[model samples]
Target chain A: MVTFALHGVGVSGGIAIGRAQLVSHATLEVAHYVVPASRVDHEIARLELAIDEVQKELTELHGTMTRSGDLPGEFGAFLDVHWMILNDPTLSEAPKRIITEQRCNAEWALTQQMNVLIDQFEQIEDSYLRERKADVVQVVERVLKRLMGKPGSLPTSVAEERTILVAHDLSPADVIQFKQHHFAAFLTDVGGVTSHTAIVARSLAVPAVVATHNARQMIHDGEMLIVDGTNHVVIVNPDRSVLSEYRLKQSELDLERQKLKRLRGKPAETIDGHRVELHANIELPGDLAQVLESGANGVGLFRSEFLFLNRAGLPTEDEQFEAYRAVAAGLAGKPVTIRTFDLGADKQKAELDGLARVAPNPALGLRAVRFCLAEPKLFLTQLRAILRASHYGKVRLLIPMLASVAEIDATLAMIDQAKESLRERGEPFDEGIEVGGMIEVPAAVLAIGGFLAKLDFLSIGTNDLIQYTLAVDRSDEAVSHLYDPLHPAIIKLIALAIAGANRAKVPIAVCGEMAGEMTLTRVLLGLGLRNFSMHPAQVPTVKQRVLTSDVSAIRPVVERMKRTDSPAKLAALLDKLNA
Target chain B: MQIREIRLRNAKGLHARVAARVVKVAGRFRSRVVITVGERRANARSIMAVLMLAAAMGATVRLETEGPDEQAAIEAMVAVLAAAGDRA
Candidate 1:
């Protein structure tokens, strides 16, 4: 077979060499056939048997998951929903009626009823509820597979040879089942970075390339495949020389991963005995397990906006409280810094009423603390919830995008009001919960003293800090190349914030992409940053960088780096600093 | 036969998981439970039908249950519908 390459988005990073195992897309390939009048009853029986098998399959999967108790609670809930959908009369009874009326095969009859149910789901006004159509489709697909006599489970791999799954798409249920099989990697014809397949792939620490267009059709079963997730490339039926090269690279990656795993139990201390705290930034409470597994000191940033997104109306105080409490209690007394919902500016505004005016420049528009300050009720509800959760464990409140002293005073006042209300209600909370502000705006960095005096701690959000300083929208592809983090002004601002916080004895951390970049680890340490927060997957690699560096030795080079204005010269100095 | 109106108290209203809970609870009883939202009626025991109702938070839905155990079924359905958060 001729060797070829397929390119797509690599949501998970790793390398894998395996044989292709194509997951059948039964929904797309269901065969429709007319049944004779005498065979109508037999067709209806076939549909019933298929539905029964799918129900049994779901039940078995649920039992295995409950016994293992390793999957998230949501997985069990997903299985439950699929089970209910399978048994719903629309799925179970309507299809039989369609088979009797249309005199069609079992698969075709089921697909016809599924389309009708999906059409009804499409009429749902709520976006979140409407997305349930995918569940309906997935459930029908399961029954279709059974009706076609194709078992849904993966074929056991040949001894010692890895198997990679290639499919048009994967439902969350399918991914959950794949977890038990330990597939080497996943290649989907369509999905984005936030797709269920991508999220599960990252958690599994496997190589996955999504949105491969027609990967399901192009690659044949049992074809020799090489998945380079970091580079977002998949090689099929590779030549001998190429196969050997990829095999060598794959082993190197494996060895590096093993080395990182060993560092999980080690402290993030520099060679000169200076200790650095490495924390993880999580978007949801479910990520706490990974944070602990990565050996992070605590959660540095919990973007609470996730609870407020993708739903109609704002999250109620009780709803928000449960989420915050889960993270706080899960940490077992470790610090969990929960940032209040930082909505607006790239976040959907449909949920928040009266904030729908499209700003000329959304980044500079009313967002973050400004948006919260504008809507005091929303802000206070979140504040009350966070305060209530503080009773569980070490919880800190971090305010985002504070550009003025007035915003700081106002936010502090709102928080005080929240506490007073809780006290009146006899609700217990940590009275001395540390409050912090994100130093993202250049103005905030310049006026760092006001923040240092008012807030209990400070965190440098380098992504926004660089964006505001350079006046570039990073998401705009045309001007994204101009967004540089290594600019002299950006470095000076970060250094200033760190120095100010250190002078006042206030805790400081960098919780942005800059903190996770292993190449810039020494640079940050030299600037007196003792705390780093990043994605859990990045902690070990950055900790490895921290383990080898001497902060005192890099200070002079860092000072020189601060003085350098030329980009090329700065790049050279960065190389030398790492060396 | 029993009919009563109950407002949805959950923040997410009748989303998938909540609908599943309703369906599971309704399936336990022999009553034919029908939930009506602004003239859109759905059998509470069918998740697909209940989800298509799309009753948001604070939406006042009419629950009608009729069978030998209609009284107990309506009470249970009311408890699930009036639940706050995901407690149901």
Candidate 2:
């Protein structure tokens, strides 16, 4: 066997050594066979039966999704659209007509009709709508699998936990079904970092390499596969020495993971007895279980935008309230700071008309607090819901992208109005809930005195802060290398915010990718950062870093790091601080 | 037969979910609903046909209905098309 490698985008970070379990692409394997005149009706009946079975299957899956509430709203809406397409005469009826006219097998007829619809979808100019072709393909594949007597499920004979799933592409529905199996890793031939497959893979905390281009076609079933997700490489049929080398690396990772688990129950305190608070940033209430298991002090940033994304309509206040209340109450009296819907700029929904226009520069355009102020009705609805949820547990409201004191005053006024409306309606809420501002914009950091005086707390969003400070779009690959978190200016801005908040005696935390990053953990602690919020899976590892550090000793090293403008000196200073 | 013209008022025009909603509304009446956008015509009860029309926001579409409930069908189809910001 030849040992080779495949490289792609690594959306999640980990290592997995398992046998490749190929996911059969039913759409590509369709066979065309002509039916006799006498059997045309039989072929049509077969297609109908398959459609019926698929409809039932979709209905049951939807019910299970609703009952468990494990998946997001977008997944449920996708299922509903699939169900509608399955029942539409355009899908269920067109293929039967083709079967009669062409005297072909059920699968062949369905494939022909699917091709016609995909051609029409290809002509669509709107990218978002054109992407609906994938949904149609997924729906048709389900029915085809039924007609072929294939159940469209993972092979149960294998030990699924030790299996690496290799597929050409995976729809959101397929990813949801695979989530229950707890596969070791996922490798697909096509998907970007923001693809549904990648998002699910990250949440699963598994090693996944997407856009492999040909991993599904080249690798045979039951082949030895080593998925190095951190390096975005997959090794197939590795030689003996290479296998042993990877085995050692794999065990080292496992042992380190086990060691981190032991730190979960221990306090995230430094060697000098300075206590640090570690919180988890969650997007959905379903993540509460993992948050608790990781022993996070509380929920740091509950992004309210997930409720609004990928749906046709905005979520009603009651729906928002239910989600917020679930997370707040689930924390068992621990604080959960829910950020207002940070929609717009790569997170825009189709329902908002004002955001429909293509902004020349979305990063600098109307977003976050600006959009909220522009559309006060929508903003107030979310505010009222968050307030209502605060009655259940410790809930705080955090506003995003506040660059001006006037915007802050406008947002505070809107919150007051929401409270007034709720009081008029005779609803109960927390009278003195904390309101915080996210210091992502450089202007906000420069005007730190206003924020420290007005807001109850503060959170430094290092991702946006770095992007704005460096004038780099992190998503744009061409200039992404310029987006440096270790830049001296970023350090100065963050240090200034921390110092201002500490001087004012206001609580502050870093709730961004920087918080979980182990390399920068000591740097932040040395700069007097006592609170950190990151992904739940990252809590244990960062906690491990916090336990071994001496904050008092690293402060001077970090101070020297803060003054150096040279990249080389800064890098060396960071090394010394960590050393 | 009754024909009425209305422009799509939703931000996304006739996207998949919106097209599906149109098909569902058209199915509720005993009328045959056919919508025409530019030169392309589609059976409103068929999701694929409705989607193939590719009607964008502000695109003028003509709705035709002929059956026992033609009047009700025209009214319902017009309402669905004219719905702004589609809070479905």
Candidate 3:
């Protein structure tokens, strides 16, 4: 028997050696034909029935995620889009017309319509939005078959044996389905470091490799393969010794994962009693499930842009409210700070479609608050929803990309208008909701007095602020190494923001990717930041770091960082403090 | 219409169980209800819709509803939100 290695996404953390079971994403289009004009109404009814059936299945599957809180809000939105896509005039009518015009079968007609929708989805600018093309294709392929009077089938099937699951990118639902079967690990050809697939894999403790451009092509149905997720590598056809070595490593990984699970729900305090805040950055409302599982203090950063990104048009206010309310309610009485839409120049979700705002350097261009002001109505819809959600619990409003007092004023004005709409419309609301701004831009740091004067709190968005300051995208391989938050200027900016907030007696927090890092926790704590928001996976380490630190002891490092001229020097000075 | 800023107090913020609770409370309002975190928005009445925001405990989000039963819907939804991790 010939064995081959298949490269796929490593969704879970650990590795395993098992037989391969390839479940190819299906091509469900039916080639059958025969349509008469008199039967168009019958065909339409059949099509609607098929769409409803798919929607029902989707709705039920959607419920599982909602219950798990895996990604309720945005996932719900995607379903809504599916509902919309299923209901699309072109998608529905094209098939009937083709049946009438070409006398083709429902399956054949639908296959053509699917192509049209795929073309539209592929044209979207946002990578996340573009990736949705596959979802549409899969759904259409399934729906078209049903219209053609074929037995219903899954878009993709799992192998019956313990196999390494492979795909371009699997959704959280896919991961759950995979769990029902025996899978050694997950391997996928698609997804970014921050994509949902990776996040789910990390939570599932599945070993996954993403961005494996040729995974589907490189791997066969059954193969001897090894997936090293941490290193982002996939090896095919290993010798017997290498396979045995990885098998042992896989067992070891399982033990480590068990250790991580044990840390769940435990307070992440160090030997010393210093406590730190551990928060997660959430994209969809469903991801809150993992947040709760991780026992984080609360959400540090709530990314709402995902709701609007993949859809065809702007979501209504009611749509916004439903998403916010579930999350606010989910957290019970804990504080949830929702950052307003932070879609930069690159993410165009229809309204901003084809509206290029390219600067000589997009990293330093008109984005965040600038984009919000340029689209006030869109901004107002989100603010109104958040304002309404504030009634449910302790909800804080956060604004991103505020470089000046002016942007803050403008954003606040929108909130006020939202509040007025509620008032004029006789709506009840919370008066105590706190308003905050992310201090990432140097301009915000320089104008701290102005920002803190009006804003209630500040969260240092070190990632973007540093990227903008250093003119480097951490994702850019060429300049990623230069994207250091430890740079003297970056550190100084953070320090200035923290010092200003502390002096003003206003609370300060950091919610960037850096805030979750162990190396940076001390530096931030030393800078007088008590509030933090990061990924759930990082909470323990950050908390451990915080506990080891005496809040009082951090001042010395802050002092040293200020004295250092270069980022390397600053990092060295701070490293000595941790030492 | 009813509007409010609510903090997630439950240590385990908005998982599936909480989404059910949210849907139950939000469904009482005849008004179209929407909740927002930052710029992201979703329908509060549906569990699948609500879980997408991925909001964690102690985070802040906004909830608002407009309909014939807006006030009652708001109060009930807020109450459910406040009671998320408390008991049921």
* Model 3 Cα lDDT, one tens digit per residue, A1-579: 333454434444456565444445445325565767677667767877887787676677667655655443455545545544564456666677776777666666778777776676565444434555565675675576566554333223354445676676665445445434445566667776456656556655566777788677667767766777766677777888778888888778667656666666677553445566678888767667778877788887888876653333455677788788878889988778999888765544424433445568655676777877887877888888898988887789999888888787888888888899988977677877799998888888888999878988889888878877887888677888887767788877888888889899998888987887888777787777778898776776676566567766667767888777876777677777778
TM-score of chain B of 3: 0.90
DockQ of each: 0.46, 0.36, 0.02
Write out the backbone clash pairs for model 2. Answer: none
Error of 3 at A469 (Å): 1.7
Worst lDDT window (10 residues) for model 1 chain A? A347-356
**Fnat of candidate 3:** 0.00
Candidate number with greatest DockQ: 1
RMSD, every candidate, angstroms: 3.4, 3.3, 12.0
Candidate 2, residue A451: how far the Cα is off, in Å: 1.0
Model 3 DockQ, alpha carbons vs. true complex: 0.02
Off by over 4 Å in 2: A120-131, A153-157, A347-354, B1-9, B13-15, B18-45, B49-88
Using Cα atoms with residue i matched to residue i, what is each candidate's TM-score against the true structure?
Answer: 0.89, 0.89, 0.70
